[model samples]
Target: QQTPASYYFTEKKAAETRIQPRQKFSHKGTFGHALLVAGSFGKMGAAVLSGKACLRSGAGLLTMHVPACGYEIMQISLPEAMTTVDKHEKINTQLPELDAYSAVGIGPGIGKEQPTVELVEKLLDTIGVPLLIDADALNILSENRQLLDKLPAKTILTPHPKEFQRLAGDSSNEFERLEAGRQFAIRHQVIICLKGANTAVILSNGDVHFNSTGNAGMATGGTGDVLSGIITSLLAQKYPAEDAAILGVYEHGLAGDRAAARRGQSALIASDVVEYLGW
Candidate 1:
């Protein structure tokens, strides 16, 4: 028989209660610094969205590492973030020194160039802090299957249906796909956020927690990048990997739900979700 929904599903009440209120005595340094490696020649918007969402989600500091071509755009669009320029004028060809940041989120808008692939490999081999991988970084992994074994314990990977399929292979249906995702998470010792209507946050130990928030309006582009930022912010704040994924997914969807309610589904965009982030 199929596992009971209650065993794996998460509800809004649980999410609401789990969210910790900021302490009045807390300073910016207490929240944590986040590093985001994102953007490219034509995709600087992704970096801007991710960086803005990261700050809005309570990260104390954010540094956006982008290709040279995106430097001006990032500076203009998200003035609050610090910038690190890559030598490549278009695609990311290098990773910044990681020791300074509390956590790192990568792969929003980064194209799958060979150098970019190498950067991902290097990140897997060296990054010691909590890491969250998304967008093309996940795609790079799909293409370079051998790197799977190098992933650090509890690294978070956010993959939509198509991306998950590429990494884990095809399944006959949703149920089969979920099981495939769970198995993949266990096998790799990673967490998987299988994004959809109710995104499933699958822990490494095989617990599947389906988010209770979010609306269909969130299907727009750049939303996933925003999620990567929020989760990375939580990770930087030192929430355990499982808590970060669960809380991040819940809050991301909740923001989408709020945006949808205000603007209506048709008018809701990824930026709207960012604006609606209330916590």
Candidate 2:
């Protein structure tokens, strides 16, 4: 049985790895650069929210690429993060080079437009680092099932039940849900994070780990977007895919807990969760 504690990550130590303490002089690049491709014409807030939360999560640098329409809004809302515009203003098609980014995050407010489908497929095929797919990007993948195996190794997929059903087919119960996630992860050589109460982190080794944090209050808009940002930021910092997902869920939910304390879950908005990210 996969217990909640199964989500605990084992620390990895390497001799060749540089161990810089907090007191040491580390540069911004010491963290990492995260490429976040999100948002569309009407869904600018999604991009802004994810970018802000990622920057807050301590990503060394964040570059958000959105539709041309969201370019100005993103730049204006997030001064700390960089912005780039694609050929289309709405992310109709085409993504930039995958090799240029340390980690990649897609989905979030991205609509399921047919052209965007082609772009998502291309990114799945070409991205060479840890990849995170959320929101409509998962929807796109469901439509393009053939591209599932093309995802890069150690990719982290953040999907709610609906999105999980699309990628992993269907599951009648939590046990079946886990089984599907397990098979999918092993088959694709990626991580599948099925988000819910006791969120499951399916690993490439066929182990199913479940998170203990989070509450029902987190079931709101932009909350999942925040999770995607946190996981992507952790991945940018070189954490393993499963580690990033587990820690990200814990931290993201912890942030939500803090926000709920202040405003109560009834009043809690997604922005409140991001506001409490300092926790």
Candidate 3:
């Protein structure tokens, strides 16, 4: 079936209008705190990338909850963000108190260990603020389908094609996949950023907004983590879920586009994308 053109939007001017300008009188607290639960023993880079992007994208205060193995790495890689070490030395096994955070983003490099799965479940049940789920967290949801109903309304899930396929089941083609995403978002009452060229931001109301920036070079690893951080930052700042997803996706891709221009598509890395985040 053909989707209506009216249902599709390109987030250029719309994203610009939604970006909140900082006021001189506004202090760090005014921007809101963001908590990121990420990383594992060998994949601490994911935590670093996400944490750095979170701070760079305007999160006033950012905290990374990582396993002991990642604590020092996160501290040195992202000194601007605070760190909370998990009890488990290799993987995340504890849920930090969420009351202080304005928003949370989870599932970067955290492996699919049983303890981490339990932690994810615990967070889902207890968290009252805006949430963003990505990477391994999305994989956990795929493995434990029952948890889908536990998702808070308007929670954002950023999934590349494979992760989305795992969550929503396989589609014969991209069109089928997009429709599946729309249905999934509507049924779950969550926002889905189906990552790809012109990545589609599917809202709970079934609206689809395609991103206007980005390049194929962004296919590198850790880029999705960067996007999760960016969106989480916006969510922390109190952007409506719809606006956060739309603008975050746009800004993430715009950064990728800028990085590609400087480093050439083949040389661009996720950190380069972070360095180019202009707004």
Candidate 4:
């Protein structure tokens, strides 16, 4: 019989099992470039936060694609990351070269514009690398349920309970929701990082790893974007899909724990979580 101890994933274990050490011969290009397609008009902060977190998590380079209106803001706010501007000033209509990036993360603060639907569809059809889907991107998937089938093998999906409900339909409780998540991962051959307390990382093999870090302090806006960045960064660093999800989720929550300790829950913000990603 399965016991609680059998399922628990603790911080100490996660730290010991984190990404491998960097080699002395490694260069900037060795880590791979990560592309983040995100932001809208007033939500440019989302793009900035995700980009910062991605770099902080060990992505060698980052290119953040945003609407033209956000170009200056992204450049000014995150000088470390390069920027690509979409044709439209407030929405993303043009898609960049999918082959250019080692990994792609999309949907933080992106509004559900009609053109974005087509862009997401085109990405799923064309992208050959691992993809991380979250926030508005998940909503777009719900609207076009058919697109779920086009997801690249081993795609990573980060969703809260409400977002999961939209994709998989309503659930009576957390138990039912998790069962659905496990089935969803198995059916689609993808990883599901179901964000919340414990943040269940459901693998395609029907295994669910519960993160034992993080705190109520992380229950605020923009934190999910940070999580997305961390996972995307891990993918860029070439961690396998299942390992990336499990390790990224654990580290993200562990950062939150550190943030809470330093700032207290009330004062902890998403940027603090990014700052505390020393592991």
Candidate 5:
């Protein structure tokens, strides 16, 4: 008897085993650098979670570019991470030099002042590598839709439904929402991970993979930040964008589930997911 395809699950170990490849003699330099730009006044938790998740996902070196005010908090909280203190207390209209990093993640807890929007545009214009974009970065894109076409090919954009609607234009229903996601990916020459129930990851070539590992417990504020980290790490480790989106989304949801199992859904924090990254 044929079972419903929606009834199946992609096991956590299945993704990890399939996606984690090998090197004959790997070194610290082999894994590649990941740069994360995150944090703001009340949202420092996003920065903390993303930095930790990147390390857990095995990025060899990480530098978090945050606003000046977050410098001491970030450094004290995560000693292993290096930071760039943008003097404006928030990342303003200046674009950081991104040439060194293999992968980048941005937009977690980034507030949308006018200058921040300009900085986002500058980053999109200047960055030459794959990116995992989230949060207010997606918001900034929605505000300025033309920036979508200018994004680097192979970049990964993680947007929740509201953000997805803003970036891809409004959707009247679920089917339209997904079609909008797929079209945006192809048009931008990148990957789109619309995070929600049965999270849909659409690629530039018109492939869509719906993930089934997460639950409503992961709807917390910092969950997307952790997801941004996972995809950033995967890209830094040289996973193709599609595989990274598929596998990273799977593992991220599973990690959230693991956190929920231990802490219960009500108390399942985003940090718990990062803590269980090794489990």
Candidate 6:
């Protein structure tokens, strides 16, 4: 079957246009503080990766909320980020003051425990700023469909194919899935960063911007967390939701392309993408 040509293209230059040079006199407070809720007992790496990427992506300050067990790991691995420990050792059950952070990114390694589910609900109720939802949070939304309407306006959701399938039901082909994603975004009044191939950014008004960066080398673990972090950082920097999704996705894929060029597709890992995120 033939696929329709995309009318919207996320050009590399356009993404670059959105990145403004920082003022030398500005303090860290000039950029926004990003709150990241991620990781579990065994998945502490996710928190580290996301936090690191957020910092590298130019967020002024980053606070990582992880399970208690990941405290030492997060502190040692990513000293640039401040760490907050959840009461639970393996999964988060508590909520934090949402007013402090300019933007919040959740999920990553978060497990789908009942307490975490409750935590997600509480977050939806409390978060007033931009939010980036991914991984387990996406899973939580897929399972608990009732929470869909509760999301903050212009919330960004990053989901791969299988994950999107769970949220919007399966489609027979990529073209069909893309259409489903468009409808899903419009129905939910949210931005969908459908990650894969040329990652598609679907807006609530039904516009689809296909990213031209990225390669097969990025098909590894932790990359999605990196993408989420980048998007969250852009949000913290005060990019509008639609612009953030489009630019972040383009830069993420561009970084992936750079990583693949240097390390080759088979050798590329999520960290490499973060390392190659050259502004």
Give the best candidate by TM-score: 3
After the best TM-score superposition of candidate 6, give how far the Cα of residue 224 lies from its true spot, in angstroms: 0.6
Tens-digit lDDT string for candidate 3 (128-196):
999999999999999999999999999999999999999999899998998999889878999999999
Q: Give a tens-digit lDDT track for model 6, residues 1-279.
A: 332334488776877787777999988998899999999989988888888888988899999999999999998999899989999989888888888899999999999999999999999988889999999999999999999989887999999988899999989998799889888887788999998988999887778888999999988999999999999998998989988899889888888988898879999999999998866
- My TM-score estimates for the predictions, one after another, are 0.96, 0.90, 0.97, 0.96, 0.91, 0.96
What clash pairs does model 2 have? Answer: 67-89, 68-89
Runs with alpha carbons beyond 4 Å of true place in candidate 4: 1-10
Local accuracy by lDDT, each model: 0.90, 0.80, 0.92, 0.89, 0.82, 0.90
Q: In candidate 3, which residue pairs clash? A: none
lDDT of 4 by residue, 89-173 (tens): 8988888977778999998999898999999999998898989999999999999999999987789999998999999999899
Clash-forming residue pairs, model 4: none
Which of candidates 1 and 2 is the stronger one according to lDDT? 1
Q: Where does candidate 6 clash, by residue pair?
A: none
lDDT of 1 by residue, 1-279 (tens): 243222356777777666767899999888898999999888888898889889888988999999999888988988888999999999988889998899999989998999999999999999999999998999999999999999999999999999999999999999899889888888899999999998999998888998888988998999998999999999988888998999999999989988998989989888998999877
lDDT, candidate 5, 163-217, per-residue tens:
8877878878997787777767776788888889778888776567778788888
TM-score of decoy 5: 0.91
Top model number, lDDT = 3
Tens digits of per-residue lDDT for model 2, 101-208: 789999999899888888888787677778898989998888888777678778888889999998888889987888778878877888888888777778877776
Q: Rank the candidates by lDDT, best first.
A: 3, 1, 6, 4, 5, 2
| Candidate 4, poorest ten consecutive residues by summed lDDT | 1-10
Which 10 successive residues of model 1 have the least lDDT summed? 1-10
Report the C-alpha displacement of residue 53, candidate 3, in angstroms. 0.4
Q: What C-alpha RMSD separates each model from the true structure?
A: 1.8, 4.1, 1.4, 2.4, 3.9, 2.4
Q: What is the lDDT of residue 158 in candidate 5?
A: 92
